[model samples]
Target: MQAKAFDTHLFKRILKYTKPYKKRYYGVVMFAILLSVFAALRPYLLKQTVDDYIAPKDEHGLLLYISMMGIVLLLETLSQFYFVYWANWLGQDIIKDIRTKLFQHILSFRMKYFDHAPVGQLVTRSVSDIEQIARIFSQGLFMIISDILKMLVVLIFMFYMNWRLTWIVILAMPVLVYITRIFQRKMQVAFEEVRNQVANMNTFVQERVTGMKIVQLFNREAIEYEKFKDINQKHNKAWIKTILYNSIFFPIADIISSLTLGAVILYGGFHILDGDKFTTFGDLFSYTMFIGMLFNPLRQIADKFNEMQMGMIAANRVFDILDSDKDVQKDGTVIASHLKGNIRFENVVFSYNDKENVLKGINLKVNEGETIAIVGATGAGKSTIINLLNRFYEINSGAIYIDEQNINEFQMESLRQQIAIVLQDVFLFADTIHNNITLNNPNISREAVIEAAKKIGVHKFIKTLPGGYDYDVKERGVMLSSGQRQLIAFLRAYVNNPSILILDEATSSIDSYSEELIQKATEKITKNRTSIIIAHRLATIVNANKIIVMDKGQIVEEGTHQELLKREQGYYKNLYDSQFALES
Candidate 1:
């Protein structure tokens, strides 16, 4: 599906979005054909007024011809308005549908996809590239079709009036067509560059903006700005290429058109002077209008072709995402209705890149309602265990089971619903605390949220904030403290009352006061609930009935705190002594 050619496959797929708006699509096509007919008829009426009505001084017939021409003009004007309106209307609606589906598709992708795909690039495809796709309908495809239809109608009239003059115009068309084909290929390539640069620029800006605090902390503003300028320059260069092609092609087209029209006029005059009876004043006048109609559309076709080319390029990028096979596999049919919290991983081997295993071959188990703590160095695969249990990323080998039922057999949604996690870096939407807590789930009422908040002792902390439950967290909860964000995340998890709870370094990076609040919240949530705590802070997980120590993607030790301390040369003992020695 090279954009240089017709791209029939890509074009048809793009138009498939209009399936729901079939009536509007038909109306636009009908209007385009009607407008073309009405357009050609105007010149014919002008020729009639001059030759039949005004020539012999018949005032009544001239007035009737004038009325008919005016009516055709009015009808053409109305049809053009509706034609443009409908096309644009269809474009906006189609893009709306595409953006929504793109978003949903993105959400359904496996966690591994996000690991490599830049947030900025995805945003560009969803927002900017999708906008360009709209131009296909609004300014590209149908507009080009209408222009082609008008040119066809004009050529028919020109030949009917005087074939000799029509031949003059047709002779110049091949050169114009040759130049147009060349221009289309150039602009298609240029616009493809433009789209790529836009995605790069978007990715840079989005990352820089999101990480502004880090940028300032690292004092890299000047470096980042220089990098942006480089990307921006490339974006500007791409647009200039398209502009250069347009500037060269259009005027050449115009000159060719003018010369052809001039040839028609000269030929018509010479014939009249030589007393050719067929070349009448009416024929000359009608031919002049016909040439205008013909050449003008030819010029617009080149302009509209660029728009369509850019649209095709954009549509190609969007379809890449829509057609992706990277989505999470959801083939299971079993509904995981209240899980009993039993979890086991047997000979599980997993890797994000498949080049190096993040979790090596291992076997582990936790009985229903048991509490276990996993302590490991950074990159020791502590978080990988929780991720596998949640099915955020499917394991590469062996299998995981919940209550002895293979996790793969359980429907993804229902299985996930039974698990709740509070991450170290909690992400809160720029919305009210209440909405963030319940995640706007209609089934979870504000009353239930407040009750859950009360149960976890976070109720008073939230009420202390201005507007309390209605307080806006702002993007990623920037308006709230790190502790406050974690507290909200806790409420979010507790409101769902998930059967399995995992706390992934939830207490490491917060103030002592917030840690106390979180500790209390954790105790309430984990009471008789299956809990797995992954933490670097040995103090936080010492009370667990069992503690597993990991080293280089494998579990090296397993025991309670007292039992682990008894091992003088164990991995857990060394890690614990080193961690607490620094604190002391």
Candidate 2:
């Protein structure tokens, strides 16, 4: 991709976040003005002390000048403190607001977006990139403004003191400005490289760490380490390139600043020795200080300009996500309450990617409070049916209805709230078991969670743990066994009292004893409720009210266990017999 230019439109959008804190922003600007005023007064007072008081041998006048100079310095120091404090405070508040907004936007995106986007890249944007934006407010824009004001005030005094010496000093400025412009362009490119490399490194590390198990299991530690080293080297080189640019540019600026000071002294010294009444030793002294002051802000402006460039680049990345239109379909206005659980899929066709259909023209129906079990091979589109019913992805064509009303007509949140799912890979947050089960929902009280856990038959297993329901699961439930995590998922779904429940390969990867317990729990939970079970093991769904056998995105058989078994050469019979023969 071509590098994004610094976008004024995006900058204006970022500035809107600071609107609520306009008073604080104004406070920073006011303090910056006061700081500049005080800074200018210091050298002017120093000149008066030397020329008017010390040269005249007036002790009282000298003392007054010294004291006033001290007072100006003190006020300058105070203004500096407030300027820094308030500017940083404003930056932090703006970034906090942006981070919250970015996160909320991310949450609204469809699963399809996440399927292709890297988790670490998103994390880096929300955390590190947002921080760069904060620096624009705190260390970049406001500070640059303060520096410019100070330089302008100093220049005014320089011209007033001795316009001839001021002209000599100003002659060297164009060279420095030319050099700074070139440096700014190069630094902008360097900073962009650094940010890109950082994102790449973050993505690699996050994926490897999350999949560390596979790395060690396959004994690929050395190979992975080498890959990480390569990424790290690229990151290091990108940073060094930035450092190299800074190292060359700042010294050139310093050299130009010194040359300007030299020119001021050369001209002022000639006029002083010529016994010109217009030029005095104090004028030369004040002019020297003012020359340094003029060039100092210019140098800082170059540095702060690079910082602003970085912030703009970061803002471009953040805005890309914010502006994305690939969010979940959430346009339905109907609020579905107490759905009777009647479901019908009519001529449904779907595809995760647009290239090929996963479920091709499927049609099925289940009455209220019936348990329907789906059995199919690995890629037979069994789970895709459940994904469609939950509206995780939009169907390419056809319609899904609940209670004789099209599912699309129901509001997304209301429809999802009425359905609960227990997936084969159970995920638990790093929190107490109780919080994990209730998911921090205040309405699901502790007593209700405990009662639900008991109904699902996972209550005794939870109580045996040291903290019972309060036990922390840690990370992705690493503290618990696979079966325990499954049980927790069951309790979580059970407490919601969903009108429709889905158990997708819920008993596939567990010990036989846990399987028996889960089966019993399943019997209780599936009773008098609409349930769909996706199972690979044919025996698990033998008692299902109606069994639907799928093959390659098409339903091949539909019947009870006995009815399907009686069919000669049927897909369900063949699948059941193969497993049964293996056991025999």
Candidate 3:
């Protein structure tokens, strides 16, 4: 574990979230103070009752003193309840705001950020890490303050009662503080390791569970189990280390507490044996109870300190994400509505991680209402072009224009509103088919979704299902077949009625019947819309007005299908001949 400096900035930022609930926070503080004052008064009242009433045989005075003691206890109990209630309430409200802000920040990041980030790590940050922050308020920070205040009041009353006995107890203070500092430093490293191990385990579990089908299909279940066992073991070790530190520190604190009590009894007993007029049995008894009160909070302070450290660690992890600059730059002020869908790429260069260019000086143009097909071998920059067009990744150089205006000049939301894409690997949420289609957009009504399904020729198939549009797709649409999922995706895209539609190998993996239905849908949807089709199946795009053949990230030929076939040694011709021979 690495050493981290105390982050004053992070602490102040967390304090800012409490501004909204300051009234509740101040209520908790007040209750804590009252509870401490009442707690300190308990032992003083006992001493007074013993010396002034019980020793003199004053029954009426004893009864009155007992009644006052009972009232103090009741006030102490009521304040304790308010302290606990308001502290927890304040913690919950603060974490709710923090979680919402963290989620919104995550939603603002670009595709590149998510592409490299593990899903489970992000989940742990959003869920478990934020919970640790809540503990800081409820269990760590407020409790520590309350204990410190109680200790201070106890010390003040003890010294006033008997300064000599107070000095004996105070002699052990330096030793206890030194031991606690060492424990805190060691536990800080242990807690960090525990948090990291938790994140690793979450990542491993999430990935394995999501890919369980692959693990079973390839007979790698035993191998994956072994891997999981290793990660789980590491997680266990991290936790055990923290527990070991706690085990060592707590008993030492208890031993010191007992020794302090023993020292007080021996010193005060000698004074009584010597016939000191000021030392009374009630005073000695009260010192014993006060000693217990003093050491008990010291022990609790160690535990609460650990909690505070854990909260600080969690806050650092969360702040790292909140402070990141990986979000897509959405600075354009122009709001494009009802775009004409004319697109052009000029000398565009791009790379996923900037290591090597995936798209190199690519240039192309598609007029409004034109259907263009991009054909290429794998990794030949076909899909990269589509990604750049959607602004999923910013181009390294060059400019892209839509309707003779720079695409970067348009507001991202307004620009994306006019464009729709049906990806190669269709993703369907664990939701109803209707909600998945409309994506819960209030502007898209149920009737419009049904009409769009009808226009795409999938309405009959959807109606044939058990619940029609209301059917739950289950996780990743596992309840539906691959072809069925693709049909649902097509219906989802069609309902949006986007001016520019992109189909990236959308019909590659389905059965012939589904492919034929999708082809019909594609023809109907692309009739008056600018569509970009990237497909390996040459037959599917034979009617495209223009076909661009690419190899090694550069365009080798551009023409109609029949015209490309006439070339003696063209990339598209060879690709077409090879696939045609295999089909025959």
Which 10-residue span in candidate 3 carries the lowest summed lDDT?
Answer: 1-10
What's model 2's overall lDDT? Answer: 0.89
Candidate 1 residue-wise lDDT, 423-521, digit = tens = 999999999999999999999999999898888888999999999999998999999989889989988999998999999999988889889988888
> Residue 481 of model 1: what lDDT?
89
State every prediction's TM-score relative to the real structure: 0.97, 0.97, 0.97
The superposed Cα distance between candidate 3 and the true structure at residue 181, in angstroms, equals: 0.9
Candidate 3 lDDT over residue span 380-472, tens digit each: 999988887877778889999999989888888888888899888989999999999999999999999988888878999999988999999
Question: lDDT tens digits, residues 1-584, model 2?
Answer: 32354567777888899899999999999999999999988888888888999899999999999999999999999999999999999999999999999998887776778888999999999999999999999888899999999988988888888788778777888888999888888888889989999999999999999899899999999999999999999999999998998899889999998887887777778888998888888887787678778888898798898888898888889988888876646658889888889999999998889788899899999989999999989999999999889888888899999999898889888999999999999999999999998899898999999888777677899999989989999998999999999989988998998999999999999888788888998898889999999998777888888999998898989989899999999998999999899978
lDDT value, candidate 1, whole model? 0.90
The C-alpha local distance difference test score for the whole of candidate 3 amounts to: 0.89
Residue 411, candidate 3: alpha-carbon lDDT: 84
Position 343, candidate 2: lDDT? 95
- In candidate 1, residue 177 scores what lDDT? 88
Q: Which stretches of candidate 3 lie over 4 Å from their true place?
A: 1-5
